[model samples]
Target chain A: MKAIAVEPGAGDPVVVEKPVPEPAAGEALVRTLRVGVDGTDHEVIRGAHGELPAGSDRLVLGHEAVGVVEDPNGTDLERGEVVAPTVRRPPNGTNEYFERGEPDMAPEGAYLERGIVGAHGFMAEYFTSPAETLVPVPPELAELGFLVEPISITEKALEHAQAARSTVHWEPESAIVLGNGSLGLVTLAMFEEVLDIERTYCLGKRDRPDPSIDLIDDLGGTYIDSRETSVPEIPDAHEPMDLVYEATGYAKHPFDTVEALAPNGVGALVGVPDDWSFEIDGGRLHRELVLHNKALVGTVNSNRGHFEAAVDTLASIPGWVTDDLVTGVYGLDEFERAFERNESVIKTAVEFDTR
Target chain B: MKAIAVEPGAGDPVVVEKPVPEPAAGEALVRTLRVGVDGTDHEVIRGAHGELPAGSDRLVLGHEAVGVVEDPNGTDLERGEVVAPTVRRPPNGTNEYFERGEPDMAPEGAYLERGIVGAHGFMAEYFTSPAETLVPVPPELAELGFLVEPISITEKALEHAQAARSTVHWEPESAIVLGNGSLGLVTLAMFEEVLDIERTYCLGKRDRPDPSIDLIDDLGGTYIDSRETSVPEIPDAHEPMDLVYEATGYAKHPFDTVEALAPNGVGALVGVPDDWSFEIDGGRLHRELVLHNKALVGTVNSNRGHFEAAVDTLASIPGWVTDDLVTGVYGLDEFERAFERNESVIKTAVEFDTR
Candidate 1:
């Protein structure tokens, strides 16, 4: 199997062949369909992510994947049942996050030990995972394999947005997406699903007349050229914002969202930035950061429940998306091309065939 | 009547004669017994506070005071009853706090008014206020008439600590106080009232072994001389603290205290500074803040419910207080001596009817 591995710190990634993994006790083997490329994949490959497993140099990248069970299937998973693999699996096979009641915080993130940081990944023909994590996908999700992973990410993000603000029922006055990438577009999609936001603003360079911009318009999210407009163009620019989620791996996203928030507005950080050290004045944050009392939270990878909810959201596509954000689908052999044009591809998935 | 007044923009304070105020409908005439002199009065009288009302030069300066009712012989407040005046009145009141379901944000604060900033205050022979603002000083409060307002501030801070943190119980692993002034000591007392924190450290200096330091020791708090020793002297100074309340009107206090918070520890900010705007890195705070999802809060003033809660705590003070915190009493004419060497007087109250 061929895997893309990155050396520590800003280094070029290398493609190397590694041995395929065998299912251990309580684990199951799967035949890969397609792998999804995301911001996290780019981050891990650049060594900017600290959550990377120890000895990440040997890590196999790619957490967003779709597959079919090849070995023993758990009660929830079945052979030939296509499904998006859950990224949050307890590595020690125990409840490491029992205290926090969140699974993504498990010391062993899904990326590591298997294929992310220290483990073998699914950019190969075969992948093995804990039986408990191998949830079944509906048969209707065949051609839409790798895309499910990205959708799941949005599910996790929406879950996070709801938890930080209020009950999921409360919609913000307006929603803003700092970037226009596939994840950003998807984030808007999910936000529209849960909240009755009066308007959604999509911010980023509209380099060309693309479908994403059209999708943003279709979703009722007005496009904003961040380069031209100063703040306060919006009604309550410096006031409390009901909700703001950062999907860009850019470090400035948090600061931008924090400044744009209204009092008691909640800022949810879902993007994993390339820079590890983030600095700001504690005094202002203690003072102005919370006008009427707002919250700033980091929602990393989702737990199983979030993934499950993401699936439900996926099944019910809001009226906005017309399949514009998802563009390319590739085989495992196109790993190099996947990374070469990651930015251009809204959502590219790896499709696998099992004989 | 003799009153204290200051010019605008950081000027000198002087004791001058002023006209007596008349009671209107729903208003009561209070003959001030002991006027409490704390940082608020010091700041207002020096014209260093911002919330001052325009043309505040004719202002009578004092917010914390114990007084008797004179208007209705048997007004809502008895003629001989000792009480604290709730500086904020309704409609056009400086302190805009009123309960709608619950009290919203504090109105423009008590000190920023005419006698205060633009409004006249109580550091005089007589004062005018609405009948509703008087909080009856319970019979059990043997002495320390003017300590009511400071105690309310402390009570509000503890309530904030309770509301923002995860646990409802005050007795977390331990609690720490950032300063040991009147505000700091009162905060310590309020915390002790709620839970028996394993160890509460009081960090500050005393002119002659500060009165608050002695009270902290009596209440089982370990006092630290922050002026002499750096905060790092304590073990795990970099770790998150169980609960830390910054009673100091300085940024450095809360910054250092935030470092000492244990996982999920909360730092409550009640202190307001004179100069400089505040800022915080939204990304770093979300990542490195409270490990168990910690939070930091800023509480403005006591709401209606908060005032009620404050009186409840004051009524339950043990024998330890009189023997420790309350050191000496002063006559109204000795105001100069009390304000000059106030540090020497652990906690002082004035004798109004010094006939």
Candidate 2:
């Protein structure tokens, strides 16, 4: 089997050969179809984030995976069924979170994410996973099934953001996505298509002739150049947002999101920032949060329910938009192009086999 | 009528004589019986917070009042009925928040809090308010009805906190109250009597012989001396908390509360901090919030629903607990004693008349 592997504390990823493993009882052998490359993947490759499997010199590098079951191995799934595998798994046997079917809520030591943490990922030609971790995908949407993982991240984040405002009669009419990345564009689409939010805004540092910004415009969202209008200044520059969806890992966005919120507004923070310390008006931020009934909910990863929701979101998004969003799809021999960062690139994937 | 008034940027409050107010149409004239003194009152007295009404030279100082309606002024409220007036009112005309009975969610310029912001309060011998703003109280609970205002603050905070966890199967077993002030003690009592949490803890800086510490002990809550175990260290020294109720206005506690949370834990912030800038590891704090599914909700003031819930909370609390919590009750001549902070003081109030 050919696999994409990254050596921790080393440089970029490399293609390597490995033996195919047989599925154990209650496990399904999945033939990889497409594996998505995201910011976390780049971080893992650069040794900035993620961990290699224990006692292993290298780790397989893909968490956003979609495949067809090559062998059901006595599980309920059909052999040809398309599926996407969830990332987090119980580290030292089962814990309470996995027991509740919410591995996303597991604490640090209790769980590890495949491809991004302590276990090998699905970037290989073939991988075996516990049957319960596999979420079935409609065969008609299998070509775009890899998108389920990224969409699920937004699904969980928005779920919590809505939960924070549930006590009040909150109908958020306006929202702003704090980044113009691939995930941010997808989230903007979800906001417009799924949530039906009236006003949508996307913030990016790119000037004119940017594809992501164009995607935002195609989705009928206003794009605010980050250089011209910062997050906190958005209320004065445009309008106070009813919801702030923060996907930018910039350390200052969270504080600015608080200032950008309208009364009873909620901010959903999904970006994981690096260790950085800076000075901010702690008093004003704290005061705004308390007095205005504002809330900030931090979220990461996703569970099976979110994954299921993501499939529906992906189906609802226009095909032209997804075509533009996924700018690159490389084969196993050309995986390097999938990880490239260019001004025009939005999302990229490595295909091991066609669905 | 006699009232406690404070001049903006002045030294302290002073007793002054003013004409008794007349209730306008759709208004109620009330005779103040008891008004509780809190941190906001002291802040107003020291000119550290709050604004005077338009064209007024001094601002009256008290928002937590229990009174009997002297005149209903053609409204539905009956004369001689015990009532408590909600703090916030429309600054100009009715805004969305006020119209929806959620003045607590109104933005800064949209509403003003009586005795706390740009409006006159109920510390006077007599006061007049819009009939709609007063919540009728049972006469039997009127002796401790003044406690409703403080209890309402916690009521709203906990409501939002629970809402943040509504999406998950969150059954918080252990909790911590971040201050031992009157509001914190009342909140601890509510946790034991109302919420029925199994393990409760209260954090304070008080040394031995402190009445607040004794009160916490009586409520079956563990008291953590802040000087010994800081907020961030609580998880390691004691245990990671499922719920953190913050009443201390220290600038750094919000960040610490994030670190002290257990997996899927939530913190409710009610204290308003002074303007202060400091450095902290923003990355770690942001990461903790995302990975652990923890949440922090900031809340202030209260509405009619919260006040009604607070009345129930006050009634459910043990009478001896309330008796010990209110350590001092000063007459009009000894009003200054009610604002004094000492080792033995838990709660103090100014009594203009008896029930």
Candidate 3:
């Protein structure tokens, strides 16, 4: 089996031949179909984060993947069925979170994420996953299944955002996505397909007429170049946003978005900003949160339920949006080119030639 | 009519004579019975916050009052009925928050709070309020009705906290209240009475065996001296708190409380800290909030429904706790004595001779 592997602390990823994994009890051997290359993969390659499996120098690199169950030993899954494997697994020892099927909420350092952390991932010819952690995707979505993982992130965020605003009748009329990355565009698409938001906006730093901006416009949403416009000024230019979906890694957007929220509004933060210090009006921020009943929630990875919902979400999104999003697909041998990001690329996946 | 008044920059409150307020259409004239004096009153007297009504040189100094409806002109309220008047009133102009019956969620500068901001409060011998804003209280809770206003503050915080954690099956087993003042004590009391928390702890900066500590014990909760134990050390001392009710005006407790939360825990912030700058590990804090699924919500004033809930909460409190909480009651002539703070005092109120 050929797999993309990165040596811990090494600068780049390498293609290596490894023995195919064998499924143990309650595990299914999956043949990789497609693995999406995103920012996390780059981080792993750069040795900024992630871990190698115990006693191993090389770590496989992909968390967002689609695969076929090649062998379903001691499990309910059918062979050859398409599935998306969850990225995170319970720690070596059992804790309440994992026992309750909420590994996503596992405490820091308590869980291991395949490729992103201590375990092996699916950027290989074959991988083995626990039966329960594999979410079955419809055959129609097999080619587009790599998106399920990223879409699940938004599903979890929206789920919690709705939960936070449950105390009052929160019929939000407008929403803004704070980044025009693939995640942001997908979030905007989800709002259009699912939520009852009458007006939507996407904020990005790119100059006018980019793919994301065009996609947002095509989705009947407005685009604001954040470089040209400040975030706090948006609500006054338009209306106070009822919900702000922050996917930009710039930490300031979350704070600035809070200032623009309508009374009782919520901000769903999905980006993990780099460590940067900025002066914040803590008193004013606290006052707004307290007096206006605003809430901001930060969400990361998704759980099985979110993954299932993501499958449904992907199926419901306008075909054109999904088609426009997967702008590039490269053969497994062209993994380096696949990892290269560009202005026109929404998502680029490495397709496997597994047999 | 006599009223407790404070000149804008004056450091003391004095009793002054005022005209009896007449009930207008959709208004009720309430003869004050008792008004609870909390920290806000002191802040108002110090001219640190609060505003004088329209052209008046002084601001009436009470927001938590229990009174009898002396006149119910053009309203459903009946004369002689016991009521607890809510402090906040709709701003001169209308906004969705007030029109939608959620003045507590009103944006800054949108609502005027009686006694605290632009409107006169229930500190006078008689005060007028819109009939709709006066929450009806049963005769049994008349003497203790002033406690409703403060209790309502906790109700709103818990309301938002509960709403924020609604995404999961959040049956919290342990809780810690971050202050031992009247609000903190009331918060501990509410958790004991309302939530199914197995263990409760109240943190205060006081010697052991004090009234607040003894009162917490009487309520079947533990009291920790925060001077001896830091916030982050709490989980290791006992367990990571599932819920933290932070009522201390200390600016750092909320952030520290976030560090102490268990996965999926919610921190309800009810205190408004003074302007103070402190370095926070923003990256670590962001990671905790994102990876642990923790939520922190800031809640200030409460609306009529919260007041109604507060009434029920006060009535359900163990009689001894309520009796001991209001440590003193001073006549209008001795108003200065009620404003004095000491270690032994829990809560003090100004009683009016309405009869």
Say which prediction, candidate 1 or candidate 3, comes out ahead on DockQ. Answer: 3
Looking at model 2 chain A, report the run of 10 residues with the lowest lDDT sum. Answer: A248-257
Instruction: Give the C-alpha lDDT of model 2.
Output: 0.91
Candidate 3, residue A67: how far the Cα is off, in Å = 2.6
**Which pairs in model 3 have colliding backbones?**
none
Considering the two chains of model 3, state its CAPRI-style docking category: medium
Q: With candidate 2 superimposed using the best TM-score fit, by how many Å does residue A151's alpha carbon deviate from the native?
A: 0.6
Evaluate candidate 2 and give its CAPRI docking class based on DockQ: medium
Clash number for candidate 2? 0
lDDT score of residue B179 within candidate 2: 95
Put down candidate 3 lDDT per residue, A149-168, tens digits, no spaces: 99999999999988888877
Model 3 agreement with the true structure over B225-273: per-residue lDDT tens digits:
7878899999888789999888876777766877888888888887776
Ranking by lDDT: 2, 3, 1
Candidate 2 Cα misplacement greater than 4 A, ranges: none
User: Cα miss at A91, model 2 (Å)?
Assistant: 1.8
The residue-level lDDT of candidate 2 at B342 comes to: 80
Given candidate 3, what's the lDDT at residue A191? 86
Residue-level lDDT of model 2, residues B231-348, one tens digit each, is 9999999999999998988888888898889988999999999888888788778877777788879888889999999988888999989999999989899999998988888899
Instruction: Write one digit per residue (lDDT tens) for candidate 1, span A1-355.
Output: 6556655455655667767677787777787877777766666666665344554445666777778887764444566767666665455435636334455543323223234545445666678877666656666655555656666656655554454433112457877766778788887876665555766777777655766677777887777766665333443443335677666656656545556665546566666543244454445545544224444554456555656666666666643362666676665566566665533567666555634
Candidate 1 total steric clashes: 47
